[model samples]
Target: MDKKQFVDEVRSIAEGYFERGEFFCSEAVVKTINDVLDKPFDENVTKLASGFPVGIGKSGCVCGAISGGVMALGMVYGREHGQAMQEKMFPMSADLHDHIKGIYKSTCCRVMTRNFEFASPERKAHCIKITGEVAAYIAEKLYDEKVINK
Candidate 1:
């Protein structure tokens, strides 16, 4: 799909998942990431989030939504490329992270949702919205970068 379509799809998935309360599961997040893009969740994205639920200790350290954003970046920039190409794309990770942080204020669930415990229903709702917004933003950035760089 094109960039606009891709972003729209991500937004749609985010809203759907948020409504269903399935934003915490990595696979569910990955499905959201994939539905808008050309491919399914790549190994790199999942690998990073392996035990990181959100980050560090599943205490929602880095905010799963932001992790999902990072994963989306990895899929596009981490694809096999020559050393030179890889070098340029590597910097995109930081950019993507910054973008995510800017949107949600912090990549951590604690900060984004003000839920250090992460057990409350309010925190859950906040987390879902944060992830959805992050997903939409990242998808848009990916589409823009891919198109411009191509």
Candidate 2:
């Protein structure tokens, strides 16, 4: 598939996962990344992202989608014990943060959903959309970096 199609597919899968209540925002992003990478980590790797949803376990801090995107990036760019860190890790993660922040003006969950009532369908829809966007952005970045093959 071409780059745009690949990115859109990732976005759709992530959004479907969130919309179906199969996973929250963060989990959906992480799960989609893991799947796209052909399960580089075990399926349970998604648990690492579990607490990130609803803005770090509902503390209403950073956007969980961005947090998940960072974790997804780490799966590709992070280092292991006794291994040198990848130079792209920090820059790519920061780029994901900025990309989402640029769209919403803030990475805070509360701020992004400020106009919606908590637990409302509108808020859920908003989060689902954000989840898809983050997933798509991650796919595009990885594809551009040649981390993901076309």
lDDT by residue (1-150, candidate 1, tens digit) is 666676766776776765685545343455566655655555344445445455545674776665666666655566564544556455666775677678667766666666445677666666666666767776677667563221
True-structure RMSD, every candidate: 4.1, 0.7
TM-score of 2: 0.98
* Model 2: CA > 4 A from native: none
Give the 10-residue window scoring lowest on summed lDDT in candidate 1. 43-52
Give the C-alpha miss distance for residue 32 in model 1, angstroms: 2.2
State each model's CA lDDT, in order. Answer: 0.60, 0.95
Error of 2 at 150 (Å): 3.4
For each predicted model, how many residue pairs clash, with residues at least 3 apart or on different chains?
1, 0
What is the alpha-carbon lDDT of model 2 when measured against the actual structure? 0.95
